[model samples]
Structures are given as structure tokens and as C-alpha cells.
Target: MNSKIQNDIKELVEEQVISKEIAASIENYYKSKKGDTPNRLFTVFAVLGSTLVGLGIILILAHNWDSFSRSIKTVFAFTPLIIGQLIVGYTIIKKKNITWREASGVFLFFAVGSSIALVSQIYNIPGNFSSYMLTWVLLCAPLIYLLKSNALAILHIVFVTSYACSFGYFNGNNTPWMYLVLLAVMMPYYYQLLKNKKIHNITSIFNWLIPLSAVIVLGTFVKKSEELGFLMYVILFGLLYNIGKIPFFDNQKLRRNGYLILGSLGTIYMLLLTSFEWLWKDILRHEIIINSQEFYVSVVLLLVTLGVLIFSYSKKRIQNFNLFQYVFVMFTIIFFLGVSGSIISIILINLLTLILGVMAIKIGADKFHFGILNYGLLIITALIVCRFFDTNMSFVLRGLLFVSVGVGFFLTNYMMLKKQKGKIE
Candidate 1:
């Protein structure tokens, strides 16, 4: 009887009698008890510890405002910076395991270096702000190597870039060489961050900040001449478009998006540049303008660069191109060729606007996107309405034009929505 019961149990097990729900519960039970590390507690301690240290430093500095002599205070000011350097040196020599305490200490040293520089500036030191900032950044660089503190390195880079923008570029030289130097200094940290992809947010922040600083600093180089400035915009947009077209950049959402944002801003600035009178009258008028090779070279480079970018981004799947971008590029070339003030200029501009509006509607069939199309339609409609204003048209005919446009807007948008719904279904 015992053998028979055992055989029956084995047969039942072999016949898949157990439920999937029971197997899942068993798996989860094993997983929950595998490890008991307290990750959250460590994170809380890190935040609280950094905040307390920052507050303590602030209080100490505030309390010692007026006690020391000029020379004595200056020496004391360098004391923390010296001590911080020692700590960084010790970390490197020991090559010991790093803990949260060590990381906090490195961060504190960074603050000390910054504080020393700030105090020097407050006391009317002879150094320039950029020089002082460069000193602080150099002093903090050791912390990255010794403690492997990405945060401190990143903070130092941020301070350096801010210093450059405020002081280095403030004079409006807008030299591209400054941008090249800044990027060089940042390249090391960028490489380090890429190795450890966990700090994605930090890397993304630098990606945006670096490009923005470049654009701002480069703005000074853009001459007041509208033709020159617009040509620069074309070059800027072409660079951005080429960057966007790279296959490796496809998955980099932040980097790609940053390029798009910069390109859009450059495009808008170009449009405004076109409408400026100084570009047409002041720069393009005299024989001197025609004689200058720089003017012609700038114009040709803009056109050639834009053509390359457009050709590169054109792919089989990309059926809709940005009409505004194309219009801006074409207008820039034609204007440079000396056809800007002719009667055909107005007609071309109006056509460009209408085409862009239609392209916007095709790409984003939403109410907000339709506004571009509506705006273009309104401009054309206004022109036609104005033609009938002076001489022969009756009130009824004038009113009919207004009514017709309003109806056209409603019907076109409704049809777009209908098409969208049909696609969804």
C-alpha cells in the first residue's frame, strides 16, 4: 500500500498539477530575502552631511568678518586652501579605499578654494576675476584625481565656464579661440563621465552648457552687418544640422535636442538680421563692400555649408523638410547676390511664409501647429484683401474675402483632424 501511494504521488507531479501562481510566489519569496543592503540610508546621510558642512562654513565666514588685520586675514584666508591641498595629496599617497567621509572631505576642500578666491575679490585684490577663477579651478583639479569625485570635477568646470562667460567674453571679443580652450579643459571630464554612464544627467548638463557658452561667446564675432550676421547664422545652422544627421548621435536625445534648439535660435536671429536696414544700406552700398574679399567669402561659405547640410540630412524616410530653414537659406543667398530690395523680394517672402505654414501643418496635425498654417494664410489673405481696398470693390465683395478665409481655415483644420483620426483607427 505504501509503494502504491508513492507511485501515485510521483505520477501526479509529472502531470503538471502545480499552478503558475504558486511558482511565481516561490520565486519572489527567494528574491526578497537575498540581500539586505541599506541604500536609502546611505543616500540620506550623504545629503544631510553635505548640507551641514556647507552651513557650518557659511557661519564661520560670517562670524570672522572684522577680527583680523589685513596681512593676518590674508594668510588665514589661504590656510584652508593649503590644508585642502594637503588632504588631497594624502588621499593620493595613501591610495586607500574611499568612503562617504572621504568624498565629503574633498567636496569641503572645493568649497574652501572657492571661498578663498571670493574673499580675495571682496578685499579688492589686484587679480582679475578670470585669473582668480582659474586659480580656484586648478587647485580643485587634484581632487578629481585623488578622490575620484566626479561631482567636484563637474562643479569646478561649471565655475570655470561661468567665470569665462562673465569675464572672458564680457568684453565682447567673441573670439572662437576662447571656446576652443574651454572645450579642451572640459574634454577630460566629459571622457570620464562617458566611461561611467550612470552620471548621465551631469554629462547632459555640460553638453548643453558648453554649446551655449560657445554660441554666446561667438556672438561677439558676428559683425553688425546684416549680411555678415545672417551668413554666420547659416554657418551655425549648417553645423547643427550636420551634427544632428550623424548616426551615432541618433540615440543621444539630449545632445540632439540641444543642437535643434540652438539651430532654431540661430534661424530666428537670421530672420531678424534680414529685416535690419543696416545690412542692406550700410554694408552693401559702396564699392568698398564689393572690393572686400571677406564679404564675398562669408556669403559663399554660408551658401555652400547650407547646401551640404541639407543634402546630408535628406534621407528616404524624411519626406517633410523644414520649409522655414530652406526659405531662410535661399533668401540669404539671393540677398547676398544683390536682389534684396526689388519688388520680387516681397513676393518671395510671402511665398516662403505660406510654404512654411503648410509644412508645419503636415508635420504636426494639431491645433497649436495649425496656427503656423493659419498665420501664413492670413498674410496672403490680407494682401489680397488690401488690393481690393482702394478703388472698385463694394463692401459685400470685401466682406466676402474675409468670410472666405475664415471658412477656409475651419475646413482645412477639420480635414486635418479627420485624417489624423482615420490613421489612428
Candidate 2:
């Protein structure tokens, strides 16, 4: 605590406004709180600084790589790896410091990757990006548990997810189930961190990374069953949203809650895309079904989503019973109706979007949260902007519509500000 604050507490005690006991407690509370802030900040900077230093080393080597003889190139490749391993081993055995742990972990992570790249380049190995990432992540995986480094764990997930996307999604091949095995490698360390109740930035990083990785890697599971893939995506998003609402994650900031953010945005984007009639037409026109592994996965995901939705609704756990909450049901209905070639599906989808925006505005107004209100307005504005591309609408009508919507935006905001001022007065 600062001297001024200490003096202020003493003054309160002298004036008999607070007891000596209370003043002492306040001073102790502030002292402890102030102490933790710096350690957390230092941990953040140490990891980032180490990451930059490691990357710099790799960049310097890459630049000078072509000028070196093959033997020297091989020596340089293993040099960082050996040096990083020594640092990390020393950190684990002797230092056991946060800064050392993070710095060494980061350096070792990059060392592993750069070493693999150098070796591949020297041997002229015909490996793809996916193989390169997989090798690096596997080599780095043991560091997570051995060094007990959460940052390295995060790096492992990131590189592995990248590998999955590059190999499976981009290459149009099924992602090997080995992805699950690699993820499981980090789970023991993840559980240990959670058990320790470490509410640091590392915890938040895991919360965001794991869900995001799942979302990306799940796409690779889809193959010939492209049509059923929409169902899979909906189920995946619903499950993510529900998972984010768990007691452990729900208390976190919205940005840190990856599942909630990704699920909501993904659901909204999908709904908006399907709001167009052409997509529904295409689905009905090509009514093909392939009972592949993707089909089974979709069914399982759908069942899980259905269970979660029912439980949440029954328990009244869904705080925001907005359009996002009901989107899965709405989409399922629309999918069936559209399959039968009904134009009503298109109409209902548009109506749902309109209702979502309006309800968002109502909720925002009730709560007096302008950010939420503006978000609702932005959604409506996005819908309007999209309509500008419609050939069926005349250019004059579109221009007039834009002007009217702009006026509404300005007028509504003005009214809200006036109401806020009135409330203050």
C-alpha cells in the first residue's frame, strides 16, 4: 500500500469511523493483492520475451542458412536444441523459477521446430506442412509435463491443431484419430493445473485454445457427407455454448470464454448464411446421403446437443433465451422443411433473424447496456447491407432504404442518450 492510503486508514481509525482492527485488515488486504499483480505481470513478459528471442534465433539461422556448408548447417540445427534442453533441464532441477520455466519452455519449443525444419531442409525431406508441425509438437509434448509449463502446453495444442487443419481440412483427407491421442498427452498436466486452482493467464489461455482447436479440427471429420455437415456444425456449436456455461468457465470474462464466443458467432454466421434462399435450394436440389463416419459423428453430436439444450431449458440455466439459444431447433425444422422443397423455410429464417435483432435491442434497453444495443443495431445494419446486393431490388429503393435506416440509427441513439441524461438528472 502507498503511504497516502496508509495515512488515510490511520485517519479513519483516529476519527473512530473505523476500528484499528479494520484498518489493519484493509492494509493487509491491499498489500497481498498488490504483491500478486507484479508476479503475474512478470510471468507474462518473461514468456513473451523468451518467445521473441527464440524466434529471432530461428530467423537469423534461416537467413544465413544457405551460406553454410551441409555439416555446419547440421551442427547449427542441433545446437539450439541442445542448448534449450540444457536450459530447461537446469530450470527444472535447480531454478524452479517461473521466469526461468517460461523462458526455457518457450526457447525449447522453438528450438524443436527450428531443428526439425533445419534437418528436413538438409536432407531434402519430402514432407508436408502437416508432417512438419506434427513432428515439432510431438517433440515438444514431453516438455509440457516435464517442465510443468502451461505456455508450452498451449503451443503444443496450437501446432497440433494447425497440423490437423493443414493435413485434414485443406487436403480434403480425414484427420487421423491420432489427433485425439496427441491432445490426451497434455491432459494430465491440464488436470494438475486445474486441481491447483491457478487462476492465472495460463488458465485463460487453455480455456480459449482447447475449444478453438476442437472447432477447427472437427471440420476435418467431414468428408463426402458435406450436406450433413451443417447439422454437425450446429451440434458442435451448441455443445460448445453449453460447455462454456459450466460453473468453472461461466465466471470468466466473455473474451476468455472461447466456447461461448465461438459458438455464438458461429451459430449467428451460419444462420445468416442460410437466411438466403439459394442455399436451401441447393440442398434440396442435391439430396444425396452418404452414411460415412461423418454421418455417425453428426448423429452423436446432435444427440449430445439435444440433451444439453433440454437440460439447460428445464433447469432455467439459459440466462439468455435469445435467438441463439433456439437456433438449433429452428435450424433442424428449417432443414427438414427445406429438404421437402418448401419456400417457407427461407421466410422463417429471415423472420428469425429479424426477431433475434429486435429481442437483442429489447434486452439491451432493459439492461441499459449500449454495447448490446449497438450490437443489435449492427446486426440489422448487416442484414440491410447484404440486401443491397440483391438484383431484385431497384437501386433507388435500396438507396432510400439505406438513408431511412441511417436516420433510424441516429435517432435511436439520440433518444437513448437523452433518456440516459434524464435518468441521471
| Alpha carbon lDDT of each predicted model | 0.55, 0.79
Candidate that would win on lDDT: 2
The residue-by-residue lDDT of candidate 1 on 1-425, one tens digit each, is: 24564455456556767555654564555556544323445644663666466556656865885776777666656655666556556656776444443555554655576566647755876876566666666656555655766456556557666666655456443333343564576577667765675236656665556556556644445434434544555566645544444443434763434555565445544544444334456554433354443466466656665665556556542344555445546666555454345544434544554454456455445434555455555544645544454347887887897898888778877887777678789
**What TM-score goes with each of the models?**
0.61, 0.84
Model 1: lDDT equals: 0.55
Candidate 1 regions off by >4 Å?
A: 1-59, 70-72, 82-125, 138-161, 172-176, 191-203, 223-227, 250-256, 276-332, 338-354, 365-418
Q: Any residue pairs clashing in model 2, and if so which?
A: none
Clashes (N, CA, C under 3 Å) per candidate: 0, 0
Which candidate comes out best when scored by TM-score? Answer: 2
Residue pairs of candidate 1 with colliding backbone atoms = none
**Please, what are the lDDT tens digits per residue for candidate 2 over residues 1-425?**
89999999989999999998999899999999887554766888989988898888888988887899999999999999999999998998895777778779999899888888889989898988887888888888888877777778888888888888888877656565778899898888877776675476677778778878988888788777677777678778878877777656667666677777777667766767777777767664456474687778877887888787788778877776556666777777777787778888877877777777777677768767787677677777777776566548988888898898788778777888889889999
